[model samples]
Target: MRVEDAPEAWEVVSSTERFKGRVFDVVTDGVRMPGDEVADRDYVRHVGAVAVVALDADDRVLMIRQYRHPVRRLLWELPAGLRDVEGEPLAETAARELAEEAGHRAATWHTLVDLLTSPGMTDERIRVFLARDLTPIPEEENGFVPRHEEIGMPVEWVPLPDAVEHALMGMIHNAPAVAGILAAYAASVEGFTGLRPADAPEA
Candidate 1:
């Protein structure tokens, strides 16, 4: 059936916060199914996030290799961060993350894609921005010193096609990285006219 015509199969009867953390909140929902069955579901509520696919003069994409403890590996990923700051514009968040994680700034920005990181589990949305006209920020010139995940993150500029190959070969597992690289590659094939304005509403 088409989603627009699909019935509302599950109605939330009640919801309570099960846990609250700095990054996200877990809520337990008591839901009523269409067949009169009731069940409890737990999922995470998040503040959303942004990722940057910063393409440079020679057509290389800025990338970072960072240690993800849960995954127990240093995974290659696009510069990204949570939209934890209340009321921060999404474009600003993308720009901030690009500089913070990759130590670069972009003069041109476009909305590459909007992603739901894991739709079945969390309400985490990520806006992936295509950044161009790149300029580097010296370590001493950056506003905040890198820490935690950003500290010593391995930064690199990989050719855009190489990044897409890495993703297709299962060498790049980060969701945003895979999607951003592929999407950016596709945009290039289309002459980049498909990209939306950075401030445009999520599609």
Candidate 2:
């Protein structure tokens, strides 16, 4: 039997907004099940996001540490941001995030992986990109100013193998970061021949 995730959606009998937040909204959906039962499902509605697995000339993956209030732990993560800009390309979002958060720009980019983060609880999807041939953006040219949780965020470079180990050892808890790290390593092994174009449509 062929194993693949095919797109399918059960009938939504009704949907109501439970709460609205700046970044995402909570909605309760009454969905019709196979047994003709209507089940109420509460899930978060998100605008999606993009992340970058930036690899430097020395094969080091750029990382950032920020305090996530809900988890209450300063976790290491890739440079990522929301797809909040209307009609903006996903790759552009990833590049913007890399420049703003990590102060670097990539000469080459490719789609690494796409994730349905917590599909059971949210429709938050993220696309991770593989970036290489990086050049630092001059301090004066970087116009983005960090604020709130972004302020004082520290950026670091870790070898790809070490990043994979950290992800497997449960040191890196960010879902996108873990997924990007493993996917990048796997692609690296094959000389990144399996990667798609940065502008490839999401699967």
Top candidate by lDDT: 2
Whole-model lDDT values for every prediction: 0.90, 0.97
Clash statistics: count for each candidate: 0, 0
Pairs that collide, model 1 = none
Of candidate 1, the 10-residue stretch with the lowest lDDT total is: 1-10
TM-score of each: 0.92, 0.98
Task: Report the alpha-carbon TM-score of model 1 versus the true structure.
Answer: 0.92
Please give, for residues 1-203, the per-residue lDDT of candidate 1 as tens digits.
Answer: 55542224478999999899999999999999768898888889998899999999888999999999998999999999999889889999998888888888999999998888897789799999999999989988888777887788888989999999999999999998999999999999987898899999764
Candidate 1 Cα outliers beyond 4 Å, as residue runs: 1-10
